[model samples]
Target: MNYFKKLLLILIVLGAKLPLIAQVKLPALVGDNMVLQQNSKVNLWGWASPNEKINIQLGWQTAPVVITANPDGTWKTAVDTPKGNEKAYDITIDASNKIILHNVLIGEVWICSGQSNMYFPVGKEEGTWKTGVVNYEEEIKNANFPNIRIFTVLTKASQKPLDDVTGSWKECSPASVKSFSAVGYFFGRNLYQKLNVPIGLIASSWGGTKAEAWTSEKVLEENTDFLPILENDAKNEKLYQEKLEAYYSDLKKERIANNNDLSKSQLKKPKKEDNKTSYVLYNAMLNPLVNYTMKGVIWYQGESNAEQAYLYRSLFPAMVKNWRNDWNQGDFPFYFVQIAPHKGQNPDIREAQLISSKSIANSGMVVTTDVGDANNIHPIDKQTVGYRLSLLARAKTYNEPNLVFSGPIYNNMKIKKNRAQLFFDYAESGLVKNGDVLKEFEIAGEDKVFYPADAKIEGKTVVVSSEKVKSPVAVRFAWKAIPEPNLFNKEKLPASPFRTDDW
Candidate 1:
């Protein structure tokens, strides 16, 4: 019972304290300053000591979910989120430590996906690549709406499927907006502004990925022509990994070999063995986030698949169906960005995108034909792109009547003795041709040769005829790649690109 006994007790206490203070394991995706999908039940998960009881208290003013840590030291529980309003909340666990999540909100959460266009976020001032940094700065700084949050899935490709991912959710503001998907941020921003609802966006995208990569293997298997992707994966167990390794090895070597730094070598390769093959990206990026809830998907891909535009007739629709089945959302409204006015594509892929939207159930397509810069695939002017997408959602998904969602979409065509009559879906003021007259229509006879048609709007229908062709068998509108297709609704929304005849 002396001073020596007291000193020994203190030493023992300090030894236990060191490890406890260091004991922190957070899921990479769940970290400080991250956005969580709102209005839906969210899963906040992490790991701790084996069999240790854990409690996650979330909300500025409510009850917290409590649970006992599992045998493996991992735990997860769902917390219901509130509508958009920035409010910081404290999460205390085990009466010892607490984590604070600031500026959280509950609202509509959308998965912004597809290829590089969707991932483009480099510029804000010029808009291309979100060049204007100040726009993002102002946006993130005043991100007071606790309702808007964003989560970005880091780009990764796997030869094999992965079950979980590492990322974090943070409230949307200027600081958060910088790293957010430029296209997605603009899209959600437009929707949030219009609807006054909380907005949550999950950015899961890869540059230069094919539509096939977004489709699930099982879903791809449903199509007779697309099943080969899965068969190949099964036959060559290591094909994906080995192929990716070789690709990266070559890519890295090239960067060093060229040393040009400005070589424009496409920088990277797809994450899977077959970058162009179907469902490779789905297995990794998408599959992991399927558990999150929300509205629909906004796609901005197809450049990599441009050469296969003809095949996309089936591939694109299959991708949509696969996602619908995966999400179990039963034909949840899907809207896509038609491939923009990129020069090399010659406008072929845009038509395919239009077809995918029109031919599918509960789907829509936004026309980027009028918005993109031909030289650069990454275009600015995203403000309108997002606004157009919102119009579609507001009209179709939310059933907001009296809302003009799109430009003219081909509704039906009737062939007269010498002319084809085209009926269109939208044109608030009745189809007024842009400028002098309606441009971008073509008529092809049985020989399958097509010539420009002199088309004019007459009482909501456009009658078309080409002096170069007689007895036309099919009518084509906006069929050419980057065709200066000018048809639009009174609302100024461009008509979706289209080609009537397969030939």
Candidate 2:
């Protein structure tokens, strides 16, 4: 090289080794056509040069908010948003560089997250239900809710919590809404209709993911019961590379024996990163959106943890509490859909979920016992699920008066001689047998051997008795994996399965 060119190469090599100074950069979430929580302090955050001053000018606000980036290049500020959606707004962030976000709306924002059931979209897709829902065509054809926006988090797994995620907000249109979570779309659509305001749904979910996968590492380590999950993850981290190499070696041998060309796409995909590993999904997907202000969260997970239903009693609630703490939102509405009835599932998982809902503050559970298909775990009737969830939000969260949002919930059981009388909440309007006379009730004596019981709905309580058990000590209703119980409230909502005995 010439003298001047060699000097330039030397300078370039030194520059490559030096740290590149970062300019003002916002997360993909804080982009155009986004919706901020209305009537609340919404968190807006991004990265800038260390100790750089950031001035945020919102079109709605008269005065610009000033903040300073920390030594680590992270900056955050809360902006107050008004309730009405009279006009679109813009946000300009000036730091080392300038970034302007346009067409922002202020409204109710919610996070919809869970497993496969929550990840299922409105449109017909591969590897899910064979066909779309019964009304999928009509629903998608008429879906033109511009006021409702949705942002779906891209699936990722990480060993450590990430500071940002990859996603973008889009207006709910026919094309956009088809691939979005069906439950989330219906929930947002219902909210917009009832409140007459803009609605934003942030969906962060993964198929076949356990609750522990969405929990913080610290939270899992603190509990001794979750030690197994941590230990398994440690083992997975250690052996992942070895397993991947072995898988590729076996695939190569098999292809050679078959005299087939080794196509790159045909090669067996290595499981380098597992979505089921504990705390990875939360680190990559959820951690990045910790303080994005929202009204509440809706969850539809539990099937993955059903095998360890007993442990989930504590773990599920801990995960919720951890999320609430991380979001800095004080017990905002955490509504979840109860798992539908399916064969081969541990019934205890449903019981555990119900307990968690009651234990957690400002939480509601939507019973889906009636709408489930016994054969398919992923039920296609997500419209009912979303509508039911909306009812809970409207009645409990939004203060809608006289709304019947719940079915019969166990209150207290009264034992009179050999018969057990069941008292339930949400039966003020009286109970109604949906179809065949209230089946699936069982009565047991001190021996704890339960027998099929004949139940009679007397007023608001159901009196259950079995001739075989003269001294009934306990009673259970719809307490099986594939129960088809015919019990409901006057409002036509199905009753949640319950067991009076702890066993």
Candidate 3:
């Protein structure tokens, strides 16, 4: 070929490749069908060539935001979002190459996170063990809310923090909602129906994971009680390496013994690292999402931590604080579900959750004593759970007055002769037993020995007395692995289990 012809070809190739390298790049979340927090300055970040000038044009506004990339090729800027509306907007980014994000919405965005129950989908699969939520068929068919959107972070674990996650915003439809988080969907649906605004739910969860896996290492290190989590994780990593080495060695020997027939060998490979390892999920899943603005969070977990339920009293609150600090959003609402009645779940976990709800400010808890099943770990009635969470958000976050969002919480106990009078906080209209008589009440004397007590409701308080204990010093109600407490407030919300004594 001629020299002039070869030079032209090289120039053409370089022109095409240059734009590919220098063009702006966005995170998975800052893409099409994304929802930015309404009435707030939402952060938008991306990478580009060093010192490159970028122009961002919001469809709702006329003035374009102009910024320059840093030396490290990272750039972030805040843009104001209007109030929630049905009008669709577009975001245009102009730099080395133009990129347009279409169909953006401004509304309430919530982060839905936790373990398996939070990860449960709305529709059942054919081969999997997931039986789906109650009335799954009808629910899935009616899930056609165009204003509600969901972004599900794929399961990932890392030893170090990540820059971005793997997910995309999808419009809520029968096809899209089936695989999305059921609790997240229902919660968003309720919010959309009540507030009549665009609702965005980001589901970042994994089944059978622990709170330590979702908590940051800095927060865990601050407390001496959480030091064991880091120590145990180091030990587990070492053990995994040792097991992997042995497995490879055994597999090599098996392959040789089978005349080099790889198919005949039955040696199984060792797993790399557990998803339940400390801070792995936070590094991979949650860290990548810190830049995105959200209204609040909804969590459902604690089954795995039941063994060390005592530690969860501190661990759960620390985890919430870590996220709040990282997000830099001042004390945003964080609502969670109390671990329900199950044969394998300890009652201490529920108590720890109840304590956390009181300890943490702007936090709410949904009690599921009435909806729990003794044999099933994952409850089927997610609609009620989601609706109750939405009620808390409506009453507390959205400032809807005169709404009963919580069940009755035990306040203080007073001893009157041979009986103990139990007062509660949310029994404004008085308490009522669902059955003929109230059960699960027990009275303890000075010896700390508790016996079944006869309980009767008077006004907003319940009086308990036991013939076995003449002098009642304390009282405990629904203190068991699986309890069927019939107590409820006039709002039909069940009362959380409580004990006057620490023991």
Model 2 is weakest, by summed lDDT over 10 consecutive residues, at 264-273
Off by over 4 Å in 1: 1-39, 46-52, 60-62, 68-76, 82-88, 91-100, 122-147, 170-175, 221-223, 228-278, 328-330, 346-348
How many residue-pair clashes does candidate 1 contain? Answer: 35
Candidate 3 per-residue lDDT, tens place, 76-95, comes to: 99899999999889999999
For model 2, how does the per-residue alpha-carbon lDDT over 407-482 read when each residue is reduced to its tens digit? 9998899999988999999999999997667799999999999999999999999999988999998999888999
Q: What TM-score, over all chains together, does every model reach?
A: 0.78, 0.93, 0.95
Whole-model Cα lDDT of every candidate shown, in order: 0.73, 0.90, 0.93
RMSD in angstroms, candidate 1? 6.8
Which model is ahead, 1 or 3, in terms of lDDT? 3
Sequence-dependent TM-score of model 1? 0.78
Which residue pairs show collisions in model 3? none
**Per-residue accuracy of model 1 over 362-439 as CA lDDT, tens digit each:** 988888777877777777666677778888888887788898888888888888888999888886567766698888
| Candidate 2 Cα deviation (angstroms), residue 237 | 5.7
The clash number for model 3 is: 0
Error of 1 at 307 (Å): 1.7
Candidate 3 regions exceeding 4 Å error are 1-21, 126-129
